[model samples]
Structure formats: structure tokens, C-alpha cells
Target: MMPASSATLHVVATPIGNLGDLSPRAQEVLRTVAAICAEDTRHTGQLLSQFGIATPLLALHDHNEEAIAGRLVARLLAGESLALVSDAGTPLVSDPGFRLVRAARAAGVRVSPVPGACAAIAALSVAGLPSDRFVFEGFLPAKAAARRERLQRLAGETGTLVFYESSHRIADSLADMVQAFGAARPAVVARELTKLFETVLDGDLEALLAAVQADGNQRKGEFVVMVQGAGDDEDAKVAEGRRLYARLNEHLPPSTAAKLAADLSGAPRKALYGG
Candidate 1:
């Protein structure tokens, strides 16, 4: 049982796709709170109606969050327990409500969490990729050039790379990923997780790209794309060799820099010098 406090703000997690995934505690928080702050009031209203919860909802999305946060915090400070929820999944994980949560904490109001389903976690669990240490990069840039540039920067990541992609751009994004990270790099595309037609496809980047392109149905839903990180040994050699080459080149001839860098980084001198 949640301890009822004087001025409490509950950060509740809601179901992403399957309504059954909503936890009992989260439902209780939504039901008992003085009001629920929602990213989309209409969407939340439907969910509450389904559960027979009659709690009043206050809209607090990205656009109006800054403007409304002060008023919501005042309500919390006035001894009204408030619950914060997003359109789906956990609040503030690629969703809105950060301002209000920050305001409530800064004002000394107690904030509690009601954990539940998250799309990224759901996808990662079934991605067949390394999950011990991973990074959740919410969404990639929309433009082709920018997206590829970002992927290029993340090519050397040592932990699994997770990203959320829309149905429209999933194909293009996967193609760019294949170019940025080598075609042989292992990757997975988890689509429409926890919902009907859920699909988790794993293979090398080239194969996954081909699969997504060939099957139009595969590109019709929300996606969580996971790419295997660079191998530690090769990544370290290339990265360290480049770094040493850059510094040594400033003080010595190109050949000498390449040789010294190769010796220090255990990388071939010809490879480091583009021979």
C-alpha cells in the first residue's frame, strides 16, 4: 500500500500498447491522486474510462509544460496529491512532464515512482543483443544527412545502441545504419512491441536492411532498432592509433608518426597511414 502523504507527486508509468501491462500500483496512483497530469488528456481519458477511474486530468505536455508547471506545483504544495503520466509507458522517458516533476521536487514536495512497461526495455529484452550495458538514444535526427552523421559518431560505441524510429523512416534509418556501421555489424529491429504483429528480427546490418526493405508490412509500425556495438579489441586499436597519429603528426614526419602510433596502439603502420 502506498503511504498517503500531505503533499505527494506520484510519477506513474502507463502501458505502451497493451492495456493489460498497466500495473495495479500505477492504476491505484491514478485513481487516488487529486488529479492526473497527462501528455494527452483525450488518450488518458479513454484509458481512465476503461479502468473506471474518475480522477480529473490536467494537461501538461511539452508545449505547455513550462507555463503550467508553476500552477501544478502550487497545487501539490497545497496538499493535493498529483499523478504524472505520459500518453504511453513511463513519464519523462522520451515524453513530457519533466518541468512539473522538477518544480515539485524543487518546492520540497515528495515525488514517488510507479514503474511499469517501457517500449525500449521491452524491445531490448528480445533484441538478442548485449543488454548488460546499453545506451537508450530516444530518436535519431529526421534528415538523412544528419541521421547518418549521428550514426557515424555512434559507430564506435562499446555498448548496445538502442533507438526509437517511426514507421516511415525505419527503412531509411536502417540503410544509413548499414553505411555508418559496417554491413557485417549485427543488428535487430523490434517492431510494434507488446502489440499485435510484434516482430523481432535479428541479423547483420545488410540483411536486416534488406529484410525491412523487402517486406512492406515490417515497416508499418513503431520500431526499436538495436545495433551491436563495435568489438573492443579492434575499436581500441583504431581509435587509439588515430588519436596517437593526430598528436604525433603535429611533432614529427607522417611516416614517423604512423610508425610510433602503430607501435603504441598495436595497429599496422600501413593501415594507420592509409597505405
Candidate 2:
């Protein structure tokens, strides 16, 4: 056996949907840890109950983090090993365990990762969307105006964009994406994930929007939305500028429109002006 100086925090990844995905080692660790810190103690409690793990649980979430980290670290310092878990996926990822993980590390406590399912990665795997180079944008701002602005900011991101969204707002958000990213942009929507009704719908921005509208349940669960990266063709990029310049012909002046269109469409300002 190895030597033990003191206790450390274990950052574990819980199943996103399928309970069967929980690894055996993770199960054992959860059962024996001095305590378990979870985003929602009740939810984690249920998961632990399923596995017959009786470890004590501490509720650690966004609202209570600052007040909790100090005491949690002290417990770790006192040789109380703990496990940190989000409601789903890896801890500290769009979840509320960042402060504890950071504090534990700062205090020289050992940190171990128990890797498992992540909704974003899981969605990407089955989405048929670009995965070589991608970014996970946890969730966008909720306001329609703010969300649209955010979508505008990411209009031409080169890598495929992935974001988590609530079912209630998925339709509106997709519509905004259509406005900012274009209706014809290829996209995919993965719903419910690894659950019994897991669904993945693929289409352009508009087509997916329509499909979600037609099927009432399309907007009924956690959603992982993936938007394709900008087309790589230099000529196509130039053509995009031309199209935007045409739009600017109505809303703005030539020079101003050229800059705006270039920024939005990622085209050459000079080429847009020339066209």
C-alpha cells in the first residue's frame, strides 16, 4: 500500500443519464469517502442510495460556496477525505464545485479525478458535428436580447460551438442562433441524452427549429446544441461578405456596412467594399 499523509478531495464525474455507466472504482470511492460534496445533496443522495453507498453528503452549490469552502478545506486538513460531484458530468464544469476544488488544491490536499459521462462530450460523439476542435459554451445568457447579442458575438467562430440549454428556451435560442449564425447553418440538437428517450436531431438552423416546433416534446428536456464551424473556403468567405454587404445596403452606409459585415461574416473588408 502507498503512504498517506492526510486527506484529499476526489473530483468525480457522475452519469449524465444512464445509471449503468457509473464505474465500479467510482462506486467504491463514493462508499468510503469521509464525506461527499454535491451540487444537490438530495439528488446525489438518490444516486448513492441506488449503489448502496452510505457516505455522508454535504450540499455544496453556487449560493453557499463562499461560506462553505473554508470549512470544507478545514475538514480536508483534518484528514477527512471527501468526494465532490456535480448533478451530472465532471465536477467544477459549469457546476458549483470550483471553489472547493481550488481551495483544496491551494491547501496542498491531493485531488483525484474519477472520470465519467459529460453531456457535452456525449452529445458531440453522437451529433455527427465537428469534434476535432470544439468549444463548450456551458449556457448562454437567458435574456432574449442578451442571448441574441451573444449569438452575434459567436457568429463566425471557426470551431464547432456547443452549448447546454434548458428545454423551455431551446426554441427561442435556436431562432436567435438562426438570426446571428444564419438560417442555413448546419446544426444539431441532442435531447434527454443517455436516457430512455434520448434523441438527436440534425439539420440546418431553420430545419431543426421547424422540427422542434412540430414535435412538442423536442423542447422537453436538457439540450446540447451544436452549430457547425464556418466554411473554410476563401471564395465562400468572400461571397459571405458580398451577401452581408447587400444587407448593409438597406440598414447602413457603405464604409460602416463593410466593417460591420466583415466583422459579422468574417470576410475581408476590402473585398466586401469592392463588391
Specify the highest-TM-score model's number. 2
List, residue by residue over 43-139, the lDDT tens digit for candidate 2. Answer: 9999999998999999999999989999988988888889999999888778998888788788888888999988988999988977899978999
- Stretches off by above 4 angstroms in model 1 are 1-5, 236-275
What TM-score do all the candidates reach, one by one? 0.85, 0.87
Compose the digit string of candidate 1's lDDT tens values, residues 43-162: 999999999999999998989999989898888877899999999888998899888888888788889999998999998998889999998999999998788667766766788999
User: All candidates' lDDT scores?
Assistant: 0.86, 0.85
Query: Candidate 1 at 77: error in angstroms?
Result: 0.3
Q: Top model by lDDT, which number?
A: 1
- lDDT value, residue 205 of candidate 1: 91
Mark the 10 consecutive residues where model 2 has the least summed lDDT: 1-10
